[model samples]
Target: MITLQDLRKVYATRSGEVVALDGISLEIPQGQIHGIVGQSGAGKSTLIRCLTALERPTTGSVVVDGAEVSVLSETQLRRARRRIGMVFQHVNLFEARTAAANIAYPLAVAGVPRAERATRVAELLDLVGLGGRGDAYPAQLSGGQKQRVGIARALATEPAVLLCDEPTSALDSATTRQILRLIRDVRDRLGITVVIITHETSVVREVCDAATLLADGRIVESGPLADVVTRPGSKLSQALVPVPDVGVADQRTLVQVSAGGAQAQIAHALYAIATEPDAHVVAGAIETLGGVRVGRWHLDVPDGDRAAVLGRLRAAGLAVEEDVA
Candidate 1:
């Protein structure tokens, strides 16, 4: 539903030109929730701006739902933007407007009839789990409710793609989970493509079907969650399923082991490792991501037994990295 080809964006400042995006190429399929994660200067915001035609790429194309948005004329771009909904981290709602009116604003701008706007706003309110709260103003709503209103407003135009920029960063843990679940529910119901831009890896782990990690204005890692999380020693894998740091008493070598597959397959690997008397798990994490059970562990093993234990793990179909601190 979205495609970016060699996307690059450069900005001119007092010092010199700074490249916010460098050679970014990506594809996100319809109805998929894709996460873009990076630190502040990693070009995530620039990429989103480019995708929305808010910032033109220096020498690349931005395509969404089959339209090359980058080259569209202003008149055309305005129409094109109606098909792309944007949800911001801050719920930038008009303080005086009620939730229903806030959601109706987009439809109003689109020249929707007042009666039709009311019907659509009602449906959206119900869709986002805020049916009776349409009469409430932003000041009267909780943070999560205000965000729900933002989401409903974004969907008011029935966009083909939803661009969520830090959608859950402001919410508490429980509220974040609720919002993430709502995003998934939106995708499942409307089949709309979603691109979530976030700095939090936990957000990616919870909601993204696929993810891209950015660093230094370039893609460091990009793939389906299942594929990336399972690959041993992958940077994205480590970030998403990190093994906690735990100090062991003895001076034994630490080996990192990981595996991804069916529940039984991962369970089998765990059992095999359990049978090794000399190897003790120091830290580990197991999670079901993208329909696969993925496990990563740090094991403390005697130097003399490291080779044998690693060999056995490899033979038993687990990826192992030796002598990791």
Candidate 2:
């Protein structure tokens, strides 16, 4: 539903030119929840703004729903923007407006009729699980509730694409989970494409079908969420799912193992060898990803037996690495 080709955005400062986005090329399929993640100053927010035409790029192109947003006229862009909805980090709702009124605001802006706006507002409130809270004002609602109102308002236009910028950053863990679930529910129900921009890896883990990692205004990695999360090469993946502690004791070998129905066998063999008093199982962790097993273990043994022990481990149908003397 969205395609970016050689999308470059540069800025001029007192010092020199700054490339906020350096030729970022990406494709977001329809009906998928895609995540863009990075630390502060990663150009993630800049990229999102460019996608919605809130910020014009210095070069390249942004194609959304088949229209080249970069070339659209001011009037054309305004009309095109109506097909895209955005939920901001701060839940930018009208403070004085009630929940229902806040939701109706977008429809009103779109020139939706009064009766249709009222009906749409009611439907959106129900869709976002704020059914009767429509009478409450933003100040009267909780953080999560305010966000629900914001989501409802964004959906008021029934856009084909939704852009969420740190939607759960302000909430607690439980509330964050609730909001993520709600977003997923809405995506599934409406079949709308979603682009979530955030610095939180946990948010991506919980909600994203695919993810891209950005650094210093450039994309470093991007792929399926499961593969990217489980792969060892990604720093973002490491932060999201940390490996267990494997202390390297004296005379021990630290072996990085894969979790693939072989953990029990490896453990048993290690235990049998460690029966020699000077040997013992130190630490390990078994993690499953994409229905495959992968993990690491540390095993202590007499220095004299190291070679034999490693040989036995390999012979036992396990991939092992000798780490210690």
Candidate 3:
């Protein structure tokens, strides 16, 4: 539903040119929830802005739902924006307006009829579980409640895609979970493509179907949520589901083992690897990734040939890495 090719954004500063996004290229499929995971100054904010045409890229094409974002005229861009809704981190509600009014504001801007806007607002209020609370003002609502209003407003246009920028960062953990679930519900119910930007690995793990890891305005890694999370030594994997950190000495052998396949059962693999009678797993974890059972283990071999065992594991298509640390 979205495609970015060689997307680059540069900022002119007193010192020199500052590159906020450097050659980012990726695609988000229709009705799928994709995450752009990064830390502050990693270009997530800039990238999201570019996606919405809020910040025009220094170069490259930005296309959403078959419309070229870069080529859109002022009026064309305004129309294109209706097909893409945005939910901000701050909720960005009118302080003086009631929740229902805030949600109706978008329809109002679009010149929706009063009767139709009223019906849509009522439906959205119930959709976000804010039913009668729509009459309440933003100041009277909780943080989570306010965000729900923001979401309802974003959906007012019946957008094909929803761009959420740090939608849950300001909320508590429990509230974060609630918001994620709500986003998921929105996607399923509306069949809308969602692109969420977040710094929290847990958020990606919880809600994202696929994810891209951003660092210094570039994508360090991008793939299926499970593939990226279970990849050993990958930045995104390290952040989400990290292997046990083994304190290694030059003399001691610390071998990290990993394997993945839908057909290869973890139980069978555990029973099959018995190359050494004394070899035992010191640290390990087994989890479901992309509906497949995948595992990683840290093995400590004393008085044994570590290289031999590692070679055997690798020969069997398993990833075995020597922990130099």
Candidate 4:
């Protein structure tokens, strides 16, 4: 239940004013896992900060659960922030504190009683799959473990919204999946809205229900993950799932087959047949985009009259198109 309207954030730098966020407007539904994806300096970090009120916007309003966050007083914002929890890239866990204490720190600051804090910390430890590691310190834990602790701490207050800023950017692929699964679990169990900010689309594909693409502090595209990823020849599609960049040969026809699920399996079989004398596959990149198996197969045919072959692929319920590059 978060909505941003014409959001803009500007900073007074030595060279006039710099706009970190340029008219970013988004609505994240409650109990859904949403992703804001872009490269660094794309206003992803600034957007999240706006949500947590760590950095107020220069113009526009941020409404969370019907509360206009931008208009809140400092004291009101602090109280409102309790209902929103954030997880950072580096996880910033206190080295001196044990995992249990680290998770309990927030509650401790909020004046939670010792007995209550202990119970909450224990429950969170188990929730993050660190039940037996509460006694360990940050130095004694792996990168994933530290993040687990960070998550436990974030959920310590049972916030209605969870904002994860590059939550698994530092972890390995396997660990990243584990963390994503954990975030999903957190959303499912708590029924809380989850917003993830990442530079890579893989994270969104693995976990996000909806997504928005940001470039140069502006939202270039916003829609269902599947729609954005599957739109042929769109900037969003090319950026999210890269196709071959090389130009096609005049003697040979360039064909790209983009499909998902069962169609992808059939595409593999058809590509096997494309290895025949009439046509041959140049290069292919098969990948999962928006949680669906999709690929771009660059096929080269000797004759330009591949209309029959292309028609056959399309007749089989696959997406086939002639590629320009």
Candidate 5:
């Protein structure tokens, strides 16, 4: 339930005017995890700040939960911000405060009662898988634990939308996975809209339903994760997931054979195609995505037998294609 239309944010420096965001228009639907991915200085941070009203956009409109955030006064913007929660990369929790107290801080500021705040904090801790760690201080917790506490604190007020700014950047791979799982769980259970800004494609692949790729202060690509990852074209896509290598050999055809079972089928197919003395397999790899084995095999076959090999693969009920240059 967030929309940005022709949102532009420019900054004045000693050199000249810098366009941090150049006409970025985006829509984040409710109850879905949306990601903004790009390299450093691609306006990812600027976009998030503009959305949160921490930095006002130079032009265009920002509508969040039906309210025009761009036009709201300072006092009104503060009120609007309460409906949006943010989790920073550094897990910005008070060092002296215990986990429960850190979470209670938001409710405390919101004028929530002590008993209700306690209950809410407890529920949040449980939701973030830190139920019994409420008594621990931030110093005693691991990176992942601190982030969970940050998440609990962010959700203390039960905000409708959550903005994560490189939430897993500082954590190790294991910790990153834990934090991503926690974020996914929160989104699924609360139906809260999540907008994650990260440069890591692995993070987006694991958690995001859809993503937008930003470059040179503009959106270069935006689509569903699977479609964007599998289809080649976008520069962002190429940087994110690498395509399988298909070798080039003159006077030979590249035949792709797909089988349902394990590597044995691949070996059998190679054997069947071995009748041609010139047949050779250049590259192969098997990867499981969405619980299916999507294997890619590149074969170098003589020009004469290329059609016949393709015919045999098709007769076996497998998807076959010839690479034509």
Candidate 6:
């Protein structure tokens, strides 16, 4: 539902022209929840702005729902933007407006009838699990409640694509999970495409069907969760499925092995390691992502046995990374 072709954005600064995006080309299919993750200054925000036509790219095209967003006329963009809904990290609801009224604001702006707006607002309120809280003001609601209101408001217009910018960054872990589940629920119900921009790896792991890692305005890695996680020595793999730190003898060589897919594959990997007398498992983590069970293990082995252990792990269908730091 979204396509970015050779996208590039440059900024004029006092020092010089700063390149915020560098040749970023990506495609997100309809009804998919895609996550864009990176540290600050990685152009994540710039990329989202480009998608919304808020920040025009210096070069290349931005297409959403078949609209060439980057080149749209101002009037055209205003109309085209109706197909894109935005959810901010901060709820940004009007303080004086009740939750229901906040949700009605978008419809109001779009010239929706008051009676129709009321009905839509009510449905959105229930959709985000804020059924009766419609009457409450922002001040009276909890952080999670406010975000729900934000989500409801974003969905008020039933946009074809939902753009979430750090949607769960301000919430606690438990609340974050709740919001993530709500997003997934929204996707399942509406079948709209979702693009979540976040710095948190946990958010991507918990909610994204596919994820892209950005570094210095370039894509470091991008793919479905399963492909990225199971890739041999993948940077995304290391970040998403990190093995815990364990104190061990420095004289031993550390080898990291990861496997994703069937339960039997993980079991086989474990058995292979267990059967090796010289391989001592120091740390490990297992997680289910994209409906696949994936596991990563850090093993300490005698330097002389490193080759043999890696050979065995590879033979058992495990992706192995030797001499992991």
**Could you give the C-alpha RMSD of every candidate to the true structure, in order shown?**
1.5, 4.3, 2.3, 3.3, 5.1, 1.3
Q: Please write out the lDDT profile of model 5 over residues 3-57, one tens digit for every residue.
A: 9999999999999999999998999899889889999999999999998999999
Order of all candidates by lDDT, from best down to worst?
1, 6, 3, 4, 5, 2
Off by over 4 Å in 3: 226-234, 272-280, 302-304
List TM-score per model, in order. Answer: 0.95, 0.82, 0.92, 0.86, 0.79, 0.96
Question: What is the Cα-based TM-score of model 4?
Answer: 0.86
lDDT of 4 by residue, 11-89 (tens): 9999898899999989988998999988899999999999988999999989987789998999898778878888999
Question: In model 1, which regions exceed 4 Å deviation?
Answer: 248-251
lDDT of each: 0.93, 0.80, 0.86, 0.84, 0.81, 0.91
Best by lDDT: 1
Q: After superposition, how far is residue 91 of candidate 3 from its true place, in Å?
A: 1.5
Cα RMSD for candidate 6? 1.3
lDDT of candidate model 3 versus the reference: 0.86
Residue 112, candidate 6: how far off, in angstroms? 0.9
- Sorted on TM-score, best first, the list reads 6, 1, 3, 4, 2, 5
lDDT of model number 1: 0.93
The better-scoring model by TM-score among 4 and 5 is 4
Clashing pairs in 6: none
Instruction: Kindly list the per-residue Cα lDDT of model 2 for residues 1-325, writing each as its tens digit.
Output: 9999999999999999999999899999999899899998999999999989999999999998889999999999988888898999999999989999999988888899999998889899999898988999899999999999998888888888999999999999999999999999999999999999998977887888888888888889887655764454455555545455656655455544222334575365545444535446566555443333445445665677767766765565555545422
Cα lDDT of candidate 5 equals 0.81
Residues 46-125, model 6: lDDT tens digits: 99999999999999999999999988999999888889999999979999999999999989989999999988998999
User: Candidate 5 — number of clashing residue pairs?
Assistant: 0
Query: Which residue pairs show backbone clashes in model 5?
Result: none
User: Per-residue lDDT tens digits of candidate 1, residues 166-196?
Assistant: 9999999999999999999999999999999
